[model samples]
Target: MLFIFGISPKTVKTDQGQFVCPICKTRSAYEIKTQRNYFSLFFIKLFPVSKPRESAVVCLNCGTHMPKMVLDH
Candidate 1:
């Protein structure tokens, strides 16, 4: 018998909204996401294998990831 198992990183979007991108300097759509490592079996995610990473604000237009503090404005 053969078994396949591994760990992989996964990022999930938690929220989306409009915000001013610090780099773009304009109002644009942004996504709030968190990343975590997960245990995988046969290429399928089974469970979390590591702690959740810091959530970030990703600008859709510019594809730039900014700090969560950007949402305050």
Candidate 2:
């Protein structure tokens, strides 16, 4: 018997809002994303092995990920 199993991270867009990008230093559209770790078997997603709601803020223009403090402002 042979089986291939591994964990993969998948990022999903959850929300969008306007924010000032620290890296780009400009007001732009930011996307809120959540990363979920999935267990894969035979190249197919079987189940999630970690928390499915880890979030991040991404700048649309510069494509830089911002810290959680960026969302507070």
TM-score of each: 0.91, 0.80
lDDT of 2 by residue, 19-53 (tens): 88889899999999999999999988878889867
* Local accuracy by lDDT, each model: 0.91, 0.87
lDDT of candidate 1 over 1-73, digit per residue (tens)? 7889999999999999888788989888999999999999999999998898999989999999888987876
Q: Among all windows of ten consecutive residues in candidate 1, which has the lowest summed lDDT?
A: 64-73
The candidate maximizing TM-score is 1
Query: In candidate 1, which residue ranges exceed 4 Å CA deviation?
Result: none
Model 2, position 13, has a per-residue lDDT of 90
